[model samples]
Target: MKKEDEAKSRRSFLKKAGLGGLSLASFTGASAHIGDQIAYASQNVNRNSSPSDLKITDLRIAEIGGDVVFRTPIVRIYTNQGIVGHGDVRDGAAKEYALFLKSRLLGENPCNVERLFGIIKQFGHHGRQGGGVSGVEMALWDLAGKAYNVPVYQMLGGKYRDKVRVYCDTTVSKDPVEYANRMQARVDQGYTALKMDIGINLIKDIPGALINGHEADYNPYQHQSTKYNMTKHPFTRIQITEKGVDKLMEYLDVMRSKIGYDIPMGTDHWGHIGVNEAIKLARASERYNLAYMEDVIPWQYTDQWREITESSTTPTQTGEDIYRLEGGFEELIKTRAVDIVHPDPNTAGGILETKRIGDFASKHGIGFMHHHAAGPVSFLGCVHSAAATENFMWLEHHAVDKKDWENLVTGFDGPIVKDGYVTVPEKPGIGVELNEEVVKKYLVKGEKLFAPTPEWDKIRAWDRLWS
Candidate 1:
């Protein structure tokens, strides 16, 4: 054909294909590519998914309290594409905390996780209050991963391990021998790491174990009032006497003898004692080579954490209640105040933020350990984070003895907790679906299962933190 005829045909095709406004300059140097562009436009298109549009359609919750003490609220985020993501509010947190986020998430793309998180993060606070936003963040990641056909860990820059190391909390006993036996049982069950509650209450009945008991009638083993729960570490005015330290030492000796030094054993629930006593107790237990003395003082006392970490041979860990990395864990990690950062994903800003926390701690030469007590939904979230984090030591499995714990969810290739490690799921999203039958069997009284939440569909206030 003549050059003029070819040019006329190209112009005719461009106009017919809805590219009529293309300037000659736009394709002036690409005349040779006109045939290729026309060929591309000839292909059939699946308009329904041509651009892969996905949107959050609804959010619901199921509050289930099994044989455990905690009533866990599991949140499900449903998308228009029929893919649903699961997340769990921190145990003991209200379902409304997560439902309240429906107004902020409706019609948003779950793939824009960081953008959505920024919009909703202000609603979260430290501890259980963080559960709502964190849970929603977790669900968003799950949805995003499913939409992209990748595991949650893969969404967090791939994973470091196929199986996550889990540490189970051993049942505590007042009798030292029984306590040792119980720890051995955990070891027998395939747990290589263990944690025990070593507190003054264990030896409080022993004469001269604790000093200054007359003032507050403090009881550490059982919950009393806000007086014991809310008091800062320094203001507790409670001290473990030399005899008390010896008693704790005896318990540790029994545990060490039973579990052996090869296994990493941690201690927690040391009561509301001040820093000095915490230091003393930590020093006293150094011989046992505990994994770390957790929450030696409160997590908020950065200086005190540094003091205990510097003064004792045992590594110190905190941050289970810390909400976000920037304001809550940055100072602690930057200052090296704690030897290990123990974040509960349910409270530490969900999966990605918790991974960020682990990455930050890794930079400071600190170890990362996860603290978890909820059901398998959040537990799997931690599993993915632990699999991705290089500095992760172990994840706490709070439901070691709960027979029905593994039944709450399905989709695992094998046992949820085998021996001691949890195999990270290769499936998309969180990799498990809630067992509705089992969940309903354990639902908290008066709580509905995935009930409609219309009240949270509209915003009612000015939520912007900045003017």
Candidate 2:
């Protein structure tokens, strides 16, 4: 074709594809490279740069004031290409836990998620010890999603639901009627699922409700005694008497009658009681058709969990404090020890691992519920994972009463929680940015917001645990 004809063809193509604004002056000098430049520009339109070249540049921390129970720390992973990702360290965990991983992540491509996760996975442990590595893992997924111009759930494969069902963890009141009234208020606010604390602590003052307390001077609610918090389930030797059981039953009966059977109800915080007592409480509360009895005993006691699962009509659940899927939750799911596997993503090795736990559970006919108590960063991580995983039953919304909880982050198209469900965000990454103005208001006293973490930028020792 003639040179004028070639120019005319190019113009027609650009205009047809809505690239008419792109000047053809640059192509005049180098006709051979015109097609290449156009293709590159098309590829780079939505992205800052080539996704493969994006590198982790820095990691920073911010501690925001949480509810009375905790001060939550948020993590931000910065990349060379200007895409930043957000994550939340487990509530009450140190910022140093996540900062220490900065050395491991610096100059590495965030898109190689599994490779980066494998390199840092050794640093994580069960419970709060896993906060640092898990936080870093979450930031990686967010960065990867943004780099590719897709939502995190799409990067995980695809979504199973657009809105993840959320259950509020309602505070328990000592008075049964008051507790029922409080739960009724949550239902009035459009929550379809709820969980409340059910334990000996509520009736500890009543005569004949508890026995063997004088031996150790154990206080159920107060953790002043080392014997109460440190002792394991079987070793505690704590028992609830028939009168105590009756009081708990009465509380459940009142709650059930108030909420009715249409909404599912779950319970937790059993005050570190033992397997036998867990069974007794489970059997007594079975008539109400509770959603699931959570952490009745510690998650490590798989056999005890099996006993509770087989003996009671109530559903048994555990694993919020557990870590990793292969070793942590595999036994529980494979053995059918629990009806539901509840993983708090901040403690469960972040989003991908949590989804793996849920996928594994689905194979065994078990349910999945994510336990969440941090700020919006980790909550959205759970939202993305819940959207990707098939077995998800619900994600915990612990801040339902905290009117300002959703304000900590921006970029949400609508209300954070609508009618007891969080819409799975479609924007890149976790689909939100830190609302710096709101976050500044909630910074913990004496703590800085996204402060420099230079001290953790170097590694002094080899980290290999095996030859």
Candidate 3:
């Protein structure tokens, strides 16, 4: 009877072990994520774990004023360690993305960028969705960099340069004289490189007869009308005829004469026209010798970009919408489509990703330029990445006109930019913080923009899967 009882007890214990109760091959075959099961938990003891260990805290939106309004939703990641990572969602993107990603990131190590990005990317589509991912990634990297005691660029295989050149935007006035005066003002501020607006649509209503029935028309409501006309690319129907192209050339002539030949002038905001028209416009700008034709064609047309680059002496450039250097920039680099690769780190997956894009472009004998127009967080991020990137030509500073824009970020000792270049910060990570007072002054409706999330407080179906 004693021997029979001992055998029965052993059988019961083995049965209770479940997968451990099986043969080695059977156990391995039967278990999903066997390694994780074996590692995260020990059969020796049972400790209660809940998804709240990964609860999301909060999401807040802040608006900063500039030449253009930039409303950024900054995401804060709160961990058990009391360390928080700051992230910025792309301006004009839905705040929900930053919020949605917060759930996916709960309980995971923000330092594990590769894994987190993989999971978050499943929910991210193109365009604004891309911005949310990029912004969240920026914050994660910022947190990782702080935790690791390194600048974001150092994580990107190390720094390649110390100072990043900035490009100043010069707005065009309806009056050519006023436009010329604005161009001179940029030079007065010690800007060596300047980008000006030249939208033919702005002047479409002017009386000019085209031999090809190409007289420009105006309609503010209709996208095809004058106000909307400047929005087309070079390849589309609203393109300039030979005569119209001459008129544009005359404007460029006046601009070049004012800024002079020595200053490197760039062009942008040419509207959503198609690629063929883009080529014509680019070719026309050759007479004035522009540094590059920025966003001349729609960003998706890589073939057209290449054609324009090949046809015009001016380099073709695009990137503000691109999320990663590898996905969008790699294709352009392979084809030598653009003379320069411009990336907005906020939209281009933050510091490391932008640097990688720049490095890739450099390998192809192309220049790398950092695109701006986001908030202080993004601009600071750009400063760090551009400082470390080589083959960097110039970064954009669209809000230079805003006296309060630089003040939005704190902990930096002095003006970030002196002369025409932005100096790298010796401090850690992005090297700047938000001025609570300034943020409050500029925020819309006193929004509670950056609150801590309690990852341990929430339970969800999705959260249970990873744990």
Candidate 4:
């Protein structure tokens, strides 16, 4: 066949195989000679992804604030084919986690996702520390998906569901009636399931509610950094009196009166109380039929989690702070510590890893729920992973009230969440692009948008796990 005819046939075959029109721009940028063959940018698509030739040219990150979580570190991985993929560090996590891997990833093909993830997985640890390696993994999947012109979910063995059911986590409220009304409002707004903070503060002002009290000067609302908040559940020795359980039940009571048992509700932020208090709260919440009692104690306390799950009728959950499946989830799932395994995709090693966790959990008859409270990038990455996860119950939608949150990324039609679920996107990569103008306005203080990081481009330490 003639050269033109041959090119046409190849394009036709690729299109038929669901891998055409990648439109990746090559012969420009950093791509000199990638793989065995050469490809070029086309007029119709303009940008293209040459799968075999795709190389990670650069990785840049920006910390975005306002409307989203406190501050979510977003990463953009640029490839040789002019295809840029987006990922996000867990909200409140340092961008350094992802940027620190730049030297290891530079010049490697983005399509070698599993191989590359193994290289960087060593850098990830549990909690916010895992955000960096997880973010890099997200961007790599996005890059690989784009390179093949398929959605991220499709790359993850396709999706099991068309849309993912979302559970919105509402703000904390002190007043019993007011908190109930807030939860009701979410139900009215089409959220089928809801999660709210049922913490000590709700009953703190009530007399005889708490014992071994929080310090007066410390504001428990912005209490994350406080010495009081820093103490682990068991060490705090904090106790919630019967009155405290009564006051908390009042919140659940009032909530049930407003929204009733029809709406699936989950309670979280049950405060710094220990095993006995956690059991009390869980037992008190049983009559209300809460979806689960989340983070009853630190996830490291597998025995505590098993205790809570066994003691109460209500479901038990944890693992948002856990990293890879091998990190803590293996023990949690195998031992059946919690009824539901909650993982934030950005904090749990991104899409594939999170999906793997869910898949593993499903075999043992445990359900996985995504704990998402980040920007759209991380949220959508969770959405993709959740869609692919067969037994995932419901994914958390923390920004239900943030009107501008969905505007941060373009690619989805209408609201990202509608009627308590997010439609699985069919677009390539993570399926969204940052609305740069809107994103620039939300830049965290002193943080630039996708800034250069030549300093991080150097390998600082020997990363070998074995000599």
Candidate 5:
């Protein structure tokens, strides 16, 4: 009588619950019961948020000091559904770039990431100007991932690797051995690839090593506003003498001797040397077997880049400052101008666009590399992007020397880069939250951490682009 009653109740519940097609007779005492069926049916369901009904309510920012990771501003996109997404404006870019976009994003569904990206992408440009669009794009991906309960890379069409390899972007030193020692420390810390700046400044004071370089007075990294900083490579007429080439060789020789040639070593900060001079240095670099000579000339110089690449055995690379595909990296990849293309996701169009850039480069027989010099918020986004890129070589880690770098974000298991790689995050969204305590300590002078910005709440323009 008791078994009959239980069986009848199970059939009744299944009929009403719309699972009547399943059978009670197929069940055993330990499994296949109606209760078990109910539990299994709901295993994939999440009551987190109504993702489709989700809407953006606000956008806020927290500006951190340069030492915390290139002084990049972090943005938070709030939604009516009680979830928030985090992102980082490109290094050195003003916070206004992202704040200004708030008016345009208000009341929109952040889950429609690509669509919203297209809506505001017009306001973005090359270099740091693209920070606003790129940062917001990252936030949207985060929000969408949370709503869908999937990893950001999973939302970006899945991943190609379980972990993303990182290369140490070693701190610059005028002394080659000092720089090499810092990089050796990274190798000891388990880095498999390395990069260092070996610029004209190293040989600047050496008489007869350079010609027409007297006016080149400022360090491009420290002083971008100066005349020398604004001038292009070709315009500077900064020619390196055969002696200068030898002087550069000495640095490479010491580096190779100290760190060895087993791991890939790339070079950057060539300073504004022209196409011919870059080609000369490229030829000189052939003997050291450099992994690449980064930004030998500016990215816009496609013709000049091709000239340099074709003229030397040293691999050439550029495009860390490019924003989008069509007008940004298309010409370089199509023309086979560089052996590899690198793009910082924060400045290069965020996650998906960078993925597209890599896919496009791979189609052209070019390898893809990641460039990152910002805080961990954007660094994690770059990790997801790199994991999704099939041809990815190495993701640049500018904070390898910053001991507290990983502490800037909370809820992560271990150091971001362990044994020279960042494990692809399995958690939803970009995978971690900003550690508020650490962030407050490093906030830019007047900026609060993720402060509310009601001042940018109103859209002021008739923003339609065309008829």
Candidate 6:
């Protein structure tokens, strides 16, 4: 009779509850079952999780640049959401920095850029090696930005400009007419600012004399001189003669004449000459009224930069090698060593960090220009930063001559440059996607494309420092 009564109770409960329904008290007793199902679903969600979820993904070297520069080996960080961010290690940095620092980043949320930056920075100091941390940090922000469906500039705060102006390196030309023609061609293409490489080394190989009666300066880096007496610039024996200065002045005049007076041109690669000589040459070139003289003295010479900026009407620009904004650029900014702060994104940490550097410069009333002699990854990174910065003067496009340069990256939905300006990508992350076809075509000899990095699996004892 009892068994029959219980069976009748179950039937009634099922009929009332519909799908596996029970009375209120019975439903309370089944709560554990529902909790078990919920827990099981949660586990399934985590099953496909990635390192980016934990915030740590190992980095591996992918060599991209070779005969073709856009093929730069950039670092990519994988995340749990299947989202990845690509970052460029500094141009020509040892691959070890990226490899070693990968261990330090394991299990951290890459979105926590400041936290990861502070932790991993203990592994890096400055110079080219900082490329590892800088690159990885860039990739993290890229990932974070994508995960949030925002641009990197938007992540920093907000953008000050929709499009960023770019400066291109002037093509080297031996013939005055050829150089002038090139300058005009750049103008025709709508480049607002251009930089010329003015070094006597290329002209040295010319028969008889490169510059009329002036003896070409024999730099040890370029020529082997038994008596390498390095005096300074004006008094220095390299190109001090009136003839040498005349040759340079003639080159400048040709550029100025061909481009007319509207262009903002700058000169660089003066070679290994002292500050005093550089100052005299700068003074001599006053007729062109250049926008700025770049690297007049090695960036290390703060006092010399101050002297150059003070003595010349032209604004002096330096700081491509500077590492951090506070320590590296503090002296230069505080003292007004250079009128502009030119930072290479690869060398200057990542986007947010570079923005910090730019903001600091603004406080000191200095202008900013980004230095990018790297591939698309670094260049795009600079684009995001320049868009966010307020005091920007111009960003550089080193490979403006190559039509294929912009094609190497897959993320640009539209034209990168339009009417002399580079428009910031509106898409999430950097708005660049890697062109696998281009990578295959330009891969360095035997390099593999996006291979698995299993070597970084186990953390070595040396990986942990504090514990």
Q: Find the candidate with the highest lDDT and give its number.
A: 5
Better-scoring candidate (lDDT), 3 or 5: 5
Q: Residues 1-467, candidate 3, lDDT per residue (tens digit)?
A: 36576455444445645645544543443334445445433565523223234333343345444343476666666665555566677777766676666656666877777677777665544456677787777777766666666777787666667776788886667776678789889889888888888766555656551221234344333544454344444424554567767776777788877778999888887655667677778877888888888887767778878887888787788888787865677898888878888888777776777888988988889888888776777777887778777777888987777778777778877787777887776665677777778776766554665544444234354633353
Across 168-192, the per-residue lDDT of candidate 2 in tens digits comes to 9677899999999999999998999
Model 2, residue 360: distance off in Å is 0.5
Residue-level lDDT tens digits of model 1 in 23-141:
54545545565766657655663332211588889999988885953788999998887888899899999888888889989998988899999998888889999999989998888
lDDT of 6 by residue, 345-366 (tens): 8878878888988999999999
- For model 2, what is the error of residue 372's alpha carbon versus the real structure, in angstroms, after optimal superposition? 0.4
Residue pair clashes in candidate 4: 23-47, 23-48, 24-47, 24-48, 24-49, 25-48
TM-score, one value per model: 0.87, 0.92, 0.78, 0.88, 0.91, 0.81
Cα lDDT of candidate 3 equals 0.69
lDDT of each: 0.86, 0.87, 0.69, 0.84, 0.87, 0.74
Model 3: CA > 4 A from native = 1-69, 209-236, 451-467
Off by over 4 Å in 4: 1-47, 216-226
Candidate 4, lDDT over the whole model = 0.84
> How many clashing pairs per prediction, in order?
0, 0, 22, 6, 0, 14
Using lDDT as the yardstick, the better of models 3 and 6 is 6
lDDT of 6: 0.74
lDDT of 5 at 80: 97
Candidate 6 residue-wise lDDT at 4 = 75
Q: RMSDs, each prediction?
A: 6.9, 3.8, 12.9, 6.7, 4.3, 8.2
* Candidate order (TM-score): 2, 5, 4, 1, 6, 3
- For candidate 4, write residues 81-191 as lDDT tens digits: 898988889888988888889999999998899999999999889999999998889989888888888999998998899989999877777877888888888888888
